[model samples]
Target chain A: MFTGLSAFPLTPIDEKGIDKRAFVGLVTRLADAGVDSIGALGSTGGYAYLSREQRAWAARTAVEAAGTTPVIVGIGALRTRDVLNLAADAQSAGAAAVLLAPMTYQPLTDDEVFGLYEAVTAEISVPLVVYDNPGTTHVTFSDELHGRIAVLPKIGSIKIPGIAVEEAPGRIAVLRAVIPAHVTIGVSGDWLAAGGLLGGADAWYSVLAGLFPETVLAITRAAQTGSSAAAVAASDRLEPLWALFQRYGSLRVVSAAAESLGLVNSPNLPLPLLGLDHAARRELEAALVVLGLN
Target chain B: MFTGLSAFPLTPIDEKGIDKRAFVGLVTRLADAGVDSIGALGSTGGYAYLSREQRAWAARTAVEAAGTTPVIVGIGALRTRDVLNLAADAQSAGAAAVLLAPMTYQPLTDDEVFGLYEAVTAEISVPLVVYDNPGTTHVTFSDELHGRIAVLPKIGSIKIPGIAVEEAPGRIAVLRAVIPAHVTIGVSGDWLAAGGLLGGADAWYSVLAGLFPETVLAITRAAQTGSSAAAVAASDRLEPLWALFQRYGSLRVVSAAAESLGLVNSPNLPLPLLGLDHAARRELEAALVVLGLN
Candidate 1:
């Protein structure tokens, strides 16, 4: 169900709770820009840090705001029961699909990993996206496991993390070969989106799309049409923003960029991850000007 | 406030939830063995996988069963507020101290790391142990951050992950030099316990101690008395068990060993992490026999 340029918005939170209005506005903008899908409460959305209630609210708010745009809500947690609970909540909140990441405190065996997604998929009617973000989840989706998960009932897509810009095509090729033809392969990580699209990923599950859906959609369209020059130019234009992503994570940089562009209020992200540093903020401002984001 | 060999029990859960009787019995056994402290919900206890309510119950149960043995509760979480909430729960449950690991979803800066603990200590009356477990938390405690955390007002101990068995002594030496003398330096990860104790660490925050408290105590006492050969012999005796640890993490192996010894019922650990594999079980059985645990 998740395809093309899906925008994963940073969940903007204020002291009172999730800034519902800000979140709704963010999703509405993406929908207005005609993005393919909306992924709320993904890593960029801080699903891991928010309470269950807040996450449900995030899903509901995004879904209601996006209207016709399909919304994929992240349902990953440290426990299986928790993931199942969140998956059920996502369905009730009208999410288009629920994303599952094998996020466990202990190292999960291949069987155990499959069983986690299988258990959740059994309960929910919505398609499940196996989020293969090894960096955060600490679980590697071996090619074999990918094939195994792909065959399970309700397994719709596998969201692969993007490799270096140049390596995306090769990574996509290997994944496409292993996974069944019907299973959509989406690529995440804002910096990896252009490469992922050019490399033949079924979709770009993007962070930058949250702020600049038109820019990401342009890159996706250019790459999909085999317009290599156009895709390269679009990718090069965002190189400065990608530099900010390298210095800090996309989540921080994206939040700062959005704040600088006056697209949203200054967000108070969950603690232990502070706002962008002064140098980072200044760099973001310059990049925003250069990219005409402001 | 915390020192010596601290027994960290795996919070055995059954279908009915935290096997309360089994949990209390295990802590009682540690107290009966005259263990210095009971670390009820450390990583080995599966704190990350537990619900807040379950964790509070674990703390209260261990503290009540521990009698005079000081009880330390693990209060790590992805968000600072959740950590504070858990810390408060720990205090109300009569824990002697709270262990805080910067268990964040995103990479935390040193300032952010210190801020998390600082926020917790400001509210709680109990001491805090800086849990520096990089393997799980994904946040490294630079030596500078370690020194800064050690000097915090209510910080009592710093539980450092034991490096490789051979590297334990040097790791302990470096940590000891940076952290103040008053703040206890405790080493966890059973494989490095012997070397940690011998290298002048104030305590061995141990996993095996939860089951074989006397064995761990024997090793600790041996090291404390300058009996290096005896300590090495004691550690070497458990090499087979350590091999199991190398294969599967301590949480799984320790839970399996406990079940094999009939110390607790066969635990239904939180999913995505299964019980020990057959090979691991057989190896654990042989190790138990060798160690006279069976």
Candidate 2:
């Protein structure tokens, strides 16, 4: 079952490939900070850029480091068979769940998208989280499709994109109406965490949580405890850091933030995704200092 | 020295993995049909979907099948080091050239893009083709960047998106002026091939050429011979097939067309990219008959 702040850490790659020591360090930090789960190979993990072998290695490393904590591995790819292959690997490596994103080169029809998840779910006994990150995957899920996939066997959760903070409550309510109560509804996109939690999202699938796990968990706890003002105050302070995420991607901002806080060895965002520019790094440092993260 | 109708073929994969027999069959067919060059592992080849090992295997198969015909292998990836590694494999496989597309998950700046090519060209002895496929790579080469990259040593050619048939001549002329005389300027997007040839593009980097080489060569030859009327007539007859390419992607339409003609086992558009729909297949059949390719 997926709940609470699940930390999605960046997979650090040095010259030797998938720096196991750096990865173990980050995952152990999050586990020790008391996050509910560790989501490895998420977009922040650079799943798309890595070779299948590298990804599997990263997953194993994260799971081993996570100890008693559940590890949810992102298992998205272009092919149904490949996704199935990854899911099998994830299940074998002791992952609690495999996240599916229906990532395709061309636009997929709803039926085709459903077929992908159906194929993967049938193969893996582990629970599935339908990751609806349309921004990267380019495959948007309709409410009808959501309701359809929600009832599939071993489907534990659905990580929906963050709605506007103002619309988070209504959006959560609408999804809850159709999706079965058993399916945990988590919110992604770090900026919308407090609003989504306040609006009754069961979990926050977080990027910042990888580095600042206790801080993120604190915010989630405040929202869950019905401390509205406390949650609002916490979310308000994170706005500046979130601005860096909006300017550059969350992947870039988070990598820089982690390095600034001495969580990761280097601010090396894997290739294609460059590290933050000098000015942006300065801005991130200021935000981190103000938030008492650095 | 890339020139004439260079065929870009799809890599066939089945349950057993990269269908080596099928790939060899397709590449041999293209070589027998007298294509000027073989562009193995290009976009239509589904470069992104394949593993490094599979890609190297495909390149080797294509080169051996191509025989004397120049084989250009696509060596694009998210990381500069990965591209370099692929380029080394392509070189070892006896490929005549390696095509580099600055394909990145994150948007790359002009400097970062240049740095990638510079890093690649420094390592390999073979010429590199700067692939500017904005549709997939999400990285566009400015005219300025194009002119800048043209002068790099061993940078033999640039595969540009095809312009409209009517605008081909002018576009080719403009590029030819900035790009050196020796660097071959090839036009991709098969629908724009005839016009690109007529407009004086050095070669047609064609998808249809993979399946129907002589037919495409005939059109290119006609244009080369200054028979504009003949080239136009040939392109006009294939408009219906071009319509399918415009509606779907060239990868899908070309794969469908190739399969319908019995050139390969099936029009198996790789995963993430589905095969043609029933209605589109019907429409393709009709077009093939009219063009005498069925």
The fnat score for candidate 2 comes to 0.23
TM-score of chain B of each: 0.96, 0.96
Give the per-residue lDDT digits (tens) of candidate 1, residues A1-294: 567788889898754577777788889999999998999999989899888999888888889999999999999998888898899899999998998888856678898998887888789898999899987877888999999889888999989887777888788888889877889988887676777777778888888888888988898889888998898788889999998887888888988988877766775587767889898899899988889886
Task: Mark the 10 consecutive residues where model 2 chain A has the least summed lDDT.
Answer: A265-274
TM-score of 1: 0.97
TM-score of chain B of 2: 0.96
Every model's TM-score: 0.97, 0.92
Off by over 4 Å in 2: A106-111, A173-178, B107-109, B165-182
What digit string (tens of lDDT, one per residue) describes model 2 on residues A195-218?
998888999999889878988888
In lDDT terms, how accurate is model 1?
Answer: 0.85
Q: For candidate 2 chain B, which ten residues in a row score worst on lDDT?
A: B264-273
User: Over the stretch B1-294, how does candidate 1's per-residue lDDT look in tens digits?
Assistant: 476789888898754588787888889999999989988888888899898999999998888999998999999998887888899899999999888877866777888898888888889898888888888877788888899888888999988887676777777788878888889888887887888787778888999898889989999899989999999899988998888887888888888988887777875577767888887799889888877878
